[model samples]
Target: MIRLSNSVVLQDEELDITAIRAQGAGGQHVNKTSTAIHLRFNIQQSSLPEHYKARLLAATHHLITEDGVIIIKSQSYRSQQMNKDAAISRLVTLIRELTREEKNRKSTKPTRKSVERRLDNKNKHSIVKTLRSKVRRFFE
Candidate 1:
């Protein structure tokens, strides 16, 4: 079982994992051994809560397909078991991120002191700029 949070846990049956050949340069061993792991989880068919499923389907992650299937490929590790573990962990992280509640931003007005300070600075800047103008002689 994969634990997402205190209340959410995913069963092993929910994930479809497969072993595939790892890409890139790794000598002859890379061509002979299948060290990569491919994990697929269907959000609609899974036993996850409605909110979790909704959040996952609504997510814009590249791993998630239009049909609500999350596909994760892990090939960084040398061993198949390690790659599988990495894929599962990544899936768990993605679900946790998607389902997590976001805190709403509270709008606040500027403090009186801050506003006063800003006005004071603007006034100082205006005075400095005004002083740079060419002086006129009343006699001329």
Candidate 2:
């Protein structure tokens, strides 16, 4: 089991890793060897909690495909083993991030003093702008 958090855990079989050719400057080694790792995890079919699955789907709509697969491409390292490890690490990190519960924001209203201060600041600003206007003689 892949432990995401204290309550969240994923099965090993859920992750699918495919070896692919890595791009970029690597001389002839990049073309000769398939070192890059393509990691896929099906979010919709996984054993994750409903709330977590919903949030994951909502938060990572770009990453998740129409088929509900989460694809992660890792080619940072040259070695296949390193790339595989990196992909798995990324998957764990992503899952961990999803599992962590966000702090509930408490609903708050502006204090009476704060509201009064804001009004006072607005009045002061208005007065400053009023002073910037051209003076006019009313008793002509």
Candidate 3:
């Protein structure tokens, strides 16, 4: 079982894990051994809560496909077990992130002191710019 939070846990059967050959350079051992792990979890068919499933399905992550399946590939580890663990951990993180609630932002007005300071700075900058203009001498 993979624990997502205090109340959320995912069963092993929910995940479809497979071993595939690792890509890129790793010498001859890489070609002979399947060290990569591919994990697939269907949000619609899983035992997760309705809200969690809904949020997961609505997520726009690259790992989540249009069919409501999350696919994670882990190949950074040298061992298949490590890769599998990494993939599962990544899945847990993704679910947690997608289901987490964000606090609504409250609009706030700037403080009077801050606004005054900003206007002062703007006036200083304007004065400096105006000073840079070519001076006109009536006698010349």
Give the clash total for candidate 3. Answer: 0
**Which is better, 1 or 3, measured by TM-score?**
1
TM-score, one value per model: 0.91, 0.79, 0.83
The regions of model 1 sitting more than 4 angstroms off are none
The residue pairs that clash in candidate 1, if any, are none
Candidate 2 vs. true structure, TM-score? 0.79
Q: Where does the lowest 10-residue lDDT sum fall in candidate 3?
A: 23-32
Return the TM-score for candidate 1, rounded to 2 decimals.
0.91
Scored by CA lDDT, what does every candidate get? 0.94, 0.86, 0.93
Steric overlap count per candidate: 0, 0, 0
lDDT of 1 by residue, 69-104 (tens): 999999998989999999999999999888899999
> What is the Cα-based lDDT of residue 43 in candidate 2?
90
